[model samples]
Target chain A: MSGRPLRTFAVLGFATTHTALAAEQLLRDLGVPVTPIPAPASIGNGLCGIALRLEPGDVERADTLLERAELRVAARGDIEDV
Target chain B: MPASSSPRPVAYLDHGATSWPKPEQVVHAVTRALTDLGGNPGRGAYAMALAASRAIFESRRTCAELLGVPDSSDLIFQPSCTAGCNLMLKGTLKPGDRVVVGSMEHNAVARPLEHLARTGIEVVVVQGDRTGLVDPDDVEREVRAAPTRAVVCQHASNLTGTIQLIGDLADIAHEHGALMLVDGAQGAGHVDVDIGVLGVDAYATSGHKGMLGPQGVGLLYLSPDLDVRTQVEGGTGGGGSESPDMPIERPDRYEAGTANTPGIVGLGAGAAFLIAEGARQHRRETELVYQLIEGISQIEGFRVLGPPAGAPRVPIVSAVHERLEADRIAFALDRTYGIAARAGLHCAPWAHRTIGTVDCGAVRLGVGWGNTSEHIGLALRALREIVTS
Candidate 1:
């Protein structure tokens, strides 16, 4: 985790009317360390301000969990270390 | 048309409007013109001017090939689709004549007709089905209802990506002794358009959109049989007497003032690129659109607009969720993810009214040659997140 920068992946799909609430709910349900990340310019993953960041090592687990919850993963990328 | 060799992973899905990231060869051609042949095309008699003239001539020839017209001189270059439409509409129609337009026409066609409608000319609008399909029979009926001077319609609905049957409509218009004008804003480069085969009276198109060239360039194709009045009068570089009257010629009469030489030259390169890449590949691109429609339709709350699946359509899809506002959804997708899409009326109020999506307007996703299956899938996933959330 120290060597690898924190990676970001956009859970693609409609953030319908309840996107923020749903995002909060999903984060809580997964109980995995996650945070809201600003939409990345390099990856045009979403049109809104709701992207998710996770520790690089936990991305795979996050993807599986989101998929099981019937969410489409829009884009996956490594968070560039500034 | 500037050259950039380094490849990036950006998925360009807007070719129905204009091709993005034009081919390297088009860029090279544009570069060559800017560096070498920078003189005014038809004004001067110098070598550089001749070279510029050759570039313009070559562009006209390439446009001829694209539209399947035999004579390159029959085509005239204007600034944009609107200018081409103005030239054709203003040049041809008199005050007392009747003009019939389709409901799904872009403003380029609609505005001119609306302006003319203020005059004594009668403007009749032929409505399309809810799916954006215009019936040739309806067009025929409209033309027959009155003495129609010209029947103007778009070859494809830019908002919905619905391809109109221009040939059938042309025959219908011709039967009623009316000329047909096609706004090929969305159809020219994305689909196969054979002016010879269609036998349309006039075809107006933008160079920037679909043709994959820079803006301020458009092409107008006139049939040999139709005699159009000149919209404006000016020099055309042929040593005609400096008369205040318009030139008594086909293209020279129509094309007035200095032409967009660089834009037209780039358009030629763009057309050449289309020909070399095989323009038929657009059908394959539309298949991706079908896939998107199919995938999105399976989602419970999502509703896709435009022509039905498997219908003869271009690679454009408009859809929205039952619970989400189209603009909100579009904003969410753009802000939360990086999906670049267009939403709202898409500049065709008549089309939106016809489709009953005028209130919210549909979220439009246009796929181009540059888009891939992966991009579609990614878009679908993003849509699902926005909808289900």
Candidate 2:
């Protein structure tokens, strides 16, 4: 198997784009690497088109930080590369 | 009306109504938001959209810092403090519920409560002392007498500049199972106010007043513990489209329709300026307020309102002339002295009643972030001449 990085990543969706941006700022402040991506259509409950994508390994860490910040996490999914 | 004596620069002491000559940073931010950051925030996933969203997010963060709000999402941008008051008062209280308020409330609070009263909500007006100070014990007595849904009071009186004991009132309200709401229109940027310390359930303030921002924008800070219902409903940009109801999440739940990007940007710049230079500005303004009070009090027929010289108050001073009417003084101040001031009931008829000036009203000079000793001196000299002539 080639040593290419996996395409699958953990995505966190929110009820509004503000929350998604808020989450992005919070995780970045906490030293967690995250990217704001268009929420895949697969995440059905996502109201905001934007979502935060992080390494699958960082899902639990990101969830803990976002929850602590009181940002509502609307949905979570393991999505392929955009 | 002939233009009179020394044509000194206009003092512009009407900051109580709204601050004039906003800081340079605020002007720049507003221009940038309108020209460069023109995208509708949260409308789409384009670069411009994200840039606009980021700018607004930064603005929210700055305002949250100034207000001591832990979660930036809890603060909502309002068109005016009046709108904020309506949302908090109407959203929380229902028919048959009772609310207590101080008599010094601006019409922003009084009018909404009046509207709510027409719908069966009971509004109790607690009279303050002669100095416009509200006693916490009086609030406690009212809440103890009956189950009150909320206790509303101003952080600082717009007419008299008397600062209220908000933390004590908040404690009393919580103990009595009532929400504590503050109209900080004159308090937030004029004096130090930390929502975390004040413990108010909700604080509504205008951005243009003490905040030193432009008009058409205000702030409403909601506590995490309170569950206020939505007041306005519309598109909140790319969220909860499937659901007809407003999204349950905050920052968007209460904020409906397109965001006021330019106004929010200006307000943020104003808040940031406060964070940098507010303490020094407050000290200078307070000194000027005392000077105005002392100088005006020395005039033969004028009686300065609000707290005594040594007492703590915001940068506002009002005085009623024994011989002249309020509007006449204000008119002379503007035309002759080139000093801007406010007269009449000050949009606070109840405040005028409390001070026994409802009939004649009082001339008010509101110190702002940029007032200096010379401005106060000019005003005092102008008042002396007006009273004597």
Candidate 3:
């Protein structure tokens, strides 16, 4: 468990066409880590607008943050440390 | 269809359906089979024909070993899992016989059993839990209700990647004097399957899927004690006779027409690769799956489907946002993010109904041997972005 910092991503559930802008603001206000990585063209995990990078130990805290923001979190997972 | 106007780099994650970017060895074996061993297998005693026959025999032997079946000749190669399933269903069941199948079966097994149902075969569907795990007792109850001729279940669900308890179900089938047929379309190469220990009478598998082979090749394993009659007939090289019927031999009796020699050769090489990789692949895949499940469960309003954490399941996972249609999410993932995943019914409507995903289906991510840790991370990041937007 005490290895490299685990890069994690987070999804904020499905956003309405109208509320999408508000959702982005909400994600930022919640202090969710944002990464500017390009999406791969062949995987189908659930995501909408924002992605977060976190240590593996911080995943539970990230969940709590999203819940406090009233954002519906969808999925989170570790990425290769890049 | 024309090639893409502007090609973009994509990470393939649909290995449970069919592997993309096949290993070089698989391609080379297929090429060599077509160029060097391009003679009818088991038809002639010439050098080329003998080589072709050897290739076919070796492929069967490899498949038998992978499935943990002792007798190599008991394995028969067919065009696909659908054909193998049809042969097993039609050849084994008589009119008025009863069959028990899991609610999570693919169309290959479901459609054939449904077709047989019209012809006097009674089909009973055993329900699975919301996570797609079926209780062995439920299957046992179904079998005990009547004289069940066969019990059909999938080793892993293509939709949810939920692994079934085949050994327990097989024991129940045996106790009730019924044969068990397992659809291993999503199981074979992605996970380790021991047909002998599972006690299944027949195990049908697709080569193009988890096996990482070319299309048009599949395998069907029959237990030594199960007396499954042949449903198809054609020339099988030996036992020359004027009658145009199936041969009395083992594989020849079931394998009708000329074989896909190249595809089978490729399949053999793919199986060899899996063996070389060893069982560590399963551990790696399961680790990825656990990481994925743990990550996704934290997402509010994002209900994950299939088995819970610590469940014995494959790397395949399905989830959907409460407010989004599964297909809509799938289309966006592919079109905007370049993430390839399967959506909709996944060819098992009964499973969808059982899991309450019939209306919008489920967003399915089936990881393969070729997938890397970076690929999983990238997928998760993209999914978060898509859902948030």
Candidate 4:
């Protein structure tokens, strides 16, 4: 954990800040427990540079929740630890 | 007991400007913002700032849902409908670009486009018919004739309350490779707005109008594909604060500096209330509008303007007098009968000219959800007495 990247954490990007915030809210409401944070520059495109962070192993579950809610995710991938 | 008799209740019929007596939730939400949420939104790392940010986002989400926007971030806050218009018109139109706008457009859209026109943008004014309705075919003909960059029109005529065929107009604009911009000031909060179905490039409305939000707040919905150049630039407080350029992100790219957090929160609550109440408010307002139209039509010297009876429209009605001045009748209705109504050109001189009321601007009575049959009756009685006496 010294200088490596955020491994195991899934950064879910969205087309806009509000949609990402909505995703975070819906995920938490569904017990997925996510936070809205700034996706790193190296990460894929996201609206307003905002992203939803999910627990290391909760990526798939979070995707299911978002899909069930009809929320679109721009990009979802594990943090590339440097 | 005096049977709870009090002074006569003023019949407020100026809602076409800004609705009054907002839903209770709006009042509570604003109060909560002033009390519970206190901090610079997106400016600090403190819990209070985070809470403030949450309120702002929540408000945006509510507006997005109400407008049926596909992505919430594409919509941002503006000080008023006028400001939103400036952003859309100025941000999109360039020198020598031709833009087409409806004859019934209010100053909010007309003024900005006019300024652009002076600065080398050509603004083509499409005339409306007698009913103040802009024909989509006319717009199509204009677009097909000119090298137009965008077609702008009001969803509903504030002067005559005639709702235009926006989806039809938008389709026409799209067919000619023109972006469609809709000034939704008289629409939105009054009727159901589905931006996706309407297929507009940009739609703007004042929150204080049909939405029942407070003043100093407006909403703009833009499709994700259109890149509207930002008009205002400053600290977004999101990221890239050090960079001189505004962020490429969605709302932060548009929202500069601080915002009216409390007012916007109130707007969100108001929208949420309307959404929950469903279409009951709309149905009530429609019925009252028809009643007002019929009752006013029966008045001997009065001529109710707009689409005739049985034609679909908003709750707004404008009537010009044959023997009396419009302002004089409006003043009598207000001073004598305690009915609040708007008179004059209603910031739409062109619309008056289209409806043949430019010589003597008409009096407008805009009913809203808060009005009832008793209020309408009082207004009708006042009109009858004013014309006869």
Candidate 5:
């Protein structure tokens, strides 16, 4: 068994930077390890300024939380690096 | 009115125009935002930009709590209440769509509806009572008569200080398949306003009036269910530069262009003040309003407008003297008594017409967070002297 989690990550993009920050706060409060980073140019297609980077394993929980908070996800994709 | 070496003390009572002498916390927040958080929020990912974004988010959250909006992102910042009203009206109503309104609206709501009427939208105005209070039954009748797209009404009258039955109106609007939009310019901080409890679809209010913030910033809350079309379009700082359309998001869909960061920061402080001291402030202002109304009614030629003393109304008391012009009385109050009051139509000619004061207008004494019993007493004495002399 490996002690560390996988290096693969998923990105969550929003229509505005404010919503991304809001999601970061909400997920962080819920104990979901999320990092805010500039949305990858390829993933956002120039739609959002920032995106949330979290382990691919926690993607479902984060999506549920955002949905519960009424925040719409504009773009989502997988990324290899920070 | 040349410059004088020694300035006379002022008793500012024109809060309906916009509150004066903002709280110390509000002033400091504006200065702090200008100095420390000087970044274009939502534009960059750096530390300064992130700090600015945090400040704006905190403000939106505080405003959401105060206004009873469940989602902070649903509240959009606008330049003024008028701008919010324009966005709500023009964005929601289309050609041939009808809206029901009351006669007690400020020019903020009326003028926009007027312009919309020119574009083929039908504006149906229901008459209010002499005190500028609209009967919900009348609103129901109008809404029932036609296929109304929305019911637009002011939560409180600036000219008369009369509070309308918003809950009842909202019910009527809902039953008739119409949306309820409120112009809450005079009611947000002075009265208890919970958009969810009131069941309104939209509310537009000025930050400076009841919220005790600086001018040039306002709030508009849209229900999650309603989707209003975007009115203004520009860089929202959320990217999407290649597309001509605004992003399909909660706030970015509506809030385009750069924001008033300093103004929003100041409003956050103002909202915080209201949350902490609102109850005590409301009680004090209510007492003072009754006193002003009763004392002014005793004057020989003065008759107060709006609800009677001891009735629930905003802290506004407008009076018309039998012999003097309204503007002249306001001038005398300003120069001789150092009491600031508003006169004439108060930017609500339709309201004056409804109250039968269109011919002479009324002198309005609007109380706010800064008024005191001593100030009210001085205003009473000054009015007695002005009327008798």
Candidate 6:
């Protein structure tokens, strides 16, 4: 469900360290580049204390990539302030 | 072995009471929430408040994933498992409705039912086996004999370490058109609590005990179909502060005040640890439990409660000496050897009664991921010293 932007950052997603590492590998194979960050203390620190940081406009594409790789985003939201 | 030799190093075997020495991440998450995210969740329009609200939602999602609940919104946050049980019991049942509960239920579930009984609800206590395990067929018979509205059972006995068959019991309750309300206080983190597979209607559990979270937070899971009345009413931050009516939303309807943001934040981190390494941690605790139980069994004049050995159970072990009082032995262990343990009725008199220790509550030892053979050896040595002295 699409809603108004909720956060100040572009977009954020929570996942395990294993999943995050695997996602990085798969993204490299698919010629996609993305950087993951340690989730803000307010949100969560995922398993490795990191989450995939996405551009505000890239939320749609990132969702597609995650789906293609069969990895579920535990939580995701735009970091941009509404 | 005198005081000059120095008391043995502390052996904390009271995880069943409240896990100590929590994972570093739990403590860090708590500190981070307190220091950096100092905003009241769902209370204001500022970015700080929204961030706090977002944190809570994320924590709720993590808890839902761990319990295998399909919807995160259905899992409400409460102050403790006791409060969650109260909410479920008071929310779901009405006066004159009948409920069947296992004999070994802790006060979290039993007290609420008792309170409901005073309000005209009919609460029947079904007998558990000598091992403190409830018989599903017997519970089913109770549901069949009467028009039961619900069946309250705990996932595991805190005192006896017996693990109940919740899925089969849920099936029986469903067959009788009754709701299955489970007290997962001792069950959530230790065992496989997939709600779909277990088929329970509602499950409530503590944060600190099994999830390694702080003490102020717990979770309540309600099946999508079930409806429960709210117990408290106040501000819901639902944008209608003028009206006194509670919001009709799921969590907002149940939680009416400022949320436990820091505790829930810690829960998110701790439960994530359990979810990531649950199998490994379970194996660690299991191996430690077997070692602890085996060592305790070797002590003279000591007897562990429940089945002979190798019974399906949690990591808790309870014992009582032939001559010494349970509390006395517990005190001796602490005073003479720096070992920490719990010895009492453990707040579940029925459990002690079911295990034939109503007169003398058993000394309970709960092994956990932090415990090792060295702790067990120290505890056993202390027990030996007490018996000999």
Q: Which runs of model 5 end up more than 4 angstroms from their true locations?
A: A1-10, A54-61, A67-70, A77-82, B1-9
The regions of model 6 sitting more than 4 angstroms off are: A1-82, B1-9, B239-243
lDDT of 3 by residue, B140-200 (tens): 9888888888899999888888889999988999898899898888889877888878889
* Cα error of candidate 1 at position B37, Å: 1.4
Q: Is candidate 3 or candidate 5 better by lDDT?
A: 5
Candidate 6, residues A57-79, lDDT tens digits: the string is 66667668878877566555544
- Pairs of residues clashing in candidate 5: none
| Ranked candidates (TM-score, high to low) | 5, 2, 4, 6, 3, 1
> Across residues B31-137, which tens digit of lDDT does each residue of candidate 5 receive?
99999889888877777777888899999999989989998888999999989999988889999999999999999999999999999999999999998899999
Which 10 successive residues of model 5 chain A have the least lDDT summed? A1-10
lDDT of 6 by residue, B1-389 (tens): 23454543377888898887789888998898888778776554355665666677778878888889876777889999999999999999999899999999999988888889999999999999888989998998899999999999999999988999999999999998999999999998888789889999899999988888999999999887889898988765542344456645466668877788899999998889899988998888888778777877888888888755777688899998899899998888777787888999999988888889989899998877578878888888888888888
| Cα lDDT, model 5, residue B334 | 85
DockQ, every prediction: 0.01, 0.46, 0.01, 0.17, 0.50, 0.04
Return the interface RMSD of model 3.
Answer: 28.5
Interface RMSD of 5: 1.9
What does candidate 4's lDDT look like per residue over B1-389, in tens digits? Answer: 11234434378888998887778899899998999888877655356766777898988888989999977888889999889888989988999899999999888988888788899989999999999899999999999997889999999999989999999999999999999999999999888999999999999999998999999999888888988999899876654544688877778788887878899999999899888974999999989999999999999989999999989898899998899999999889877777889999999888888888989999999988688999899999999999899
Better of 3 and 4 by lDDT: 4
Those runs of model 4 whose alpha carbons end farther than 4 Å from true positions after fitting are A1-20, A30-82, B1-9
Report the TM-score of candidate 4, chain B only: 0.97
- Which of 2 and 4 is ahead in TM-score? 2
The best candidate by TM-score is 5
Per-residue error for B86 in candidate 5, Å, reads 0.5
Write down the lDDT of every candidate, Cα atoms only.
0.74, 0.88, 0.74, 0.85, 0.89, 0.80
Q: What is the lDDT of residue B16 in candidate 3?
A: 63
Docking class of 4: incorrect
TM-score (second chain) of model 6:
0.96
Return the lDDT, model 1, position B57: 71
Which stretches in model 2 have alpha-carbon errors above 4 Å?
A1-10, A30-32, A54-61, A64-70, A78-82, B1-9
Model 4 quality (TM-score): 0.87
